[model samples]
Target: LLSDGRAQGYVLNDDIFVFLGRGKIAGLPVMVWILILTAVAVHILLKYTDIGRNLYAIGGNDTAARLAGININKYLIAVYALIGTVA
Candidate 1:
């Protein structure tokens, strides 16, 4: 709407509210839904991907993973840094 300039003619309020059962859709509920979906997506990726498996292995046994030719501690720090960035 804003890109098309329709929004420029209107004065929009910046308040957020949560509505019950059959009320209007508001900003707060929409923001909550977006956060919840993002969390779920990250959880799924961490639990199911090959990188996630390697990460868990590194967490469980750094020395063994190093022997297996994995850069154990470096990747661990990388993963932590990535999570920090996302947060």
Candidate 2:
């Protein structure tokens, strides 16, 4: 599809030139900045946020987390929403 230009109007292609400018950063495409920023944000969230801690706890042991007073259902819903948004 990319070879045929079918995906040309997609979000990345649509804004790549505008958002990334016409230059490279640290020998990588400027678009890589988005990936770096996203990684940093996720790292910070998992390291310092309550929701992130809850998510880790649930992943480690759902039964224990629920018994420990974490709202498993709410966190599951939030996880689903986050997955949907990222998709």
Best by lDDT: 2
Q: Write the per-residue lDDT of candidate 2 for residues 1-87, one digit (tens) a residue.
A: 556855444454656566577558888877678678877887888889998899999999999999999999999998799778755
What is the lDDT of every predicted structure here? 0.70, 0.82
Number of backbone collisions per candidate, in order? 0, 0
Question: Which runs in model 2 stand beyond 4 Å of their true positions?
Answer: 1-23
Query: Across residues 1-87, which tens digit of lDDT does each residue of candidate 1 receive?
Result: 547755444334434333332234455556566667788987887799877777877878878878888877778788889878768
Per-residue lDDT value at 56 in model 1: 74
Estimated TM-score for each candidate: 0.55, 0.66
Query: lDDT, candidate 2, residue 81?
Result: 93
Worst 10 residues of 1 by lDDT: 14-23
Segments in model 1 whose C-alpha atoms lie over 4 Å from true places: 1-28
Q: Which pairs, if any, clash in model 2?
A: none
